[model samples]
Target: MKVLFCGDIVGRSGRESVTRNIPRLRQELGLDFVVVNGENAAAGFGITAKICAELHGAGVDCITTGNHVWDQRDIIPYIAQDKRLLRPINFPPGTPGWGASQYETARGQKVVVVNVMCRLFMDPLDDPFRTVDAEIAKYTLGRSAHFILIDVHGEATSEKQSMGHHLDGRVSAVLGTHSHIPTADSWVLPGGTAYQTDVGMCGDYDSVIGMKKEGAVLRFIKKVPGDRLAPAEGEGTMCAALVETDDKSGLAKAVRPIRIGGRLPPAG
Candidate 1:
């Protein structure tokens, strides 16, 4: 199975980049499934039902979110109706949307995607390790699931790496998000899971993590609340990770990072 996991989409630039390129990418990469982090898709905040439809229309199979999953008020209700969208698994039990979902490809292959958030330097939610373990215990790779992918959204690289190692061999891939910078650590773990510290944001890199540079820089320099940071309107660069898994064992055979458009050098 071939799967592509795109990083967080920040704003208009990010949305355009993804919606415009996903079709071609699906054809060129021969991707069986595509997952993108849409937490920041709505003006550097949360996503909405309209944007979710846009992504799905562009051929994205599922969408995952991080801490900013609730930034937009309307999404609270809309999320319940969208099975393809997921929030952090560690969120309180009554959270509006699902934390994980199983999807079927065109070939009738089963794929499970889990979305979990880490607590270190992030929101204090349920124990991610325990929650994920309990959630994944229901499915056995190669038996119930053809591929298992987990999106570990967090601010700390150490926490992300820890989760990756902890779930190695049990899952097909453990990819990180939330930090808007791509890391160079795309590699298959010894246990067969593909891991990357961060897949990076699909937004303009010229700004501060996809935000307008002026306001973001001011907040850091002045140490005071000035203005709300807005998304950079520049052209965006879509960043993602590609993993091809074994059909029989459901383990990753090859992993590669993908970067297209904008300032970041192209990869994959």
Candidate 2:
């Protein structure tokens, strides 16, 4: 199965870039499923129901969020009803929505999408390693599910890498998010799980992680909040990773990093 997972959509620029490219990418790449992270989609904060609808209209099959999942107060109601939107699996119990879900492609290929957050440098939530391990055990890859995509959202690279290695050979891909910067290491692990430290943000790259550059610089230099952070309005760069999985073992056969528009050079 061929799947494409895009990083966090920062704001208007990010949303526009994604909606513009996803349809073409779906046709061009012949993708079986598409997963998107919109943790920062709402003005660099949290996602909303409209944003979720837009992403769905743009051909994204599933949406994932990170630490910023609940920033927007309106999403609380929408998340409970929408099965496609997933919060971190490690979230405390009774949290609205689910962590992982199984979906079927138009071609009848079964795919499982799981979102989990790490503990280091972030919220001290449940153990992600243990949580995801138990989730993966529920379904046998290549038998029960044709593909599995895990979004490991976190700040620490070590934490993300640990999760990748921990789930290697058992799932299709274990890609990182929340850092907003894509890493250079994009390769299939020895165990056949495609891994990338971070998938990067789908927003304007000219500023500080999709934020207004001047304001971000001020906060660092002055160490005092003068104004609220705003999303950069410039043209955005769409960043994503494409993985082709083996239909037999449900392991990655090949992987490619996709970067289009804005500052970053176009990559596939």
Candidate 3:
């Protein structure tokens, strides 16, 4: 299975870049499934129903969220109905929306998409490791879940990296998100799970993780909120990780970092 996982979609730039490139990308990469983190999809905040539907129509099979899953109150109703959008699995029970979803590829293959958020420097939620472990167990019965894609959303690379190792062989791919900077450590693990420390942001590369550079700089330098930061209007890149998983064993065969457009250097 050719699965492409894109990192957080920032603001307008991210959405525009995705709308412009994803259709072509799907065709060029021969992607069977596509998952994108929509935590930052709406103006660098949370995602909404409209945006989620738009992205889905644009070829993204599933959308995942992190700590910012509920930033937009309007999503509450939409999330309840949209099975394609997933919140963090670690979120306590009774939380709105699901943490994982199952989709059928064009060829009728069962693909499972799971989203988990790390506790380190994140919300005080349930243990992601335990939650995902249980979730995996539920799906692994008789290999019901053929292809598994895990989106580990967090701030700390160590936390993300640890989750990847924890899920190593059991999953098809474990890609990190939320840092908004693509890591070079895209490789298939010893156990065959594709792993990357971060998949980066699909937005303006000239700014700080897709936010306006001047505002981000001001916040860092002054340590005070003067004005709301907006998405930068610069050349953007669609940062993602491409992974190919075996059909029979459901293990990753190859992994590669993908960067197109923007100021970021090309990924080899």
**Listing every candidate in turn, what is its Cα RMSD in Å to the true structure after a full C-alpha superposition?**
0.7, 0.6, 1.3
lDDT of 2 at 250: 94
lDDT of 3: 0.88
lDDT of each: 0.96, 0.95, 0.88
Which residue pairs show backbone clashes in model 2?
Answer: none
Q: Best to worst by TM-score, what's the order?
A: 2, 1, 3
Poorly placed runs, candidate 3 (over 4 Å): none
lDDT score at residue 138, model 2, on the 0-100 scale: 96
lDDT of 2 by residue, 79-192 (tens): 999989999999999999999999999999999999999999999999999999999999999999999999999999999999899999999999999999999999999999
- Model 3, 1-268: lDDT tens per residue? 8988989999888888787878998898898988999999889989988898899889999999998888899998889888899999888889888999888989888999999998888888899999999888877721687789999999999998898899989999999999998888999999889999999999998898889998889887896767887888787798999998888889988999888888888663
TM-score per candidate: 0.99, 0.99, 0.97
- Residue 160 displacement (Å), model 2: 0.6
RMSD of 2: 0.6
Which whole-number lDDT from 0 to 100 does residue 55 have in model 1?
97
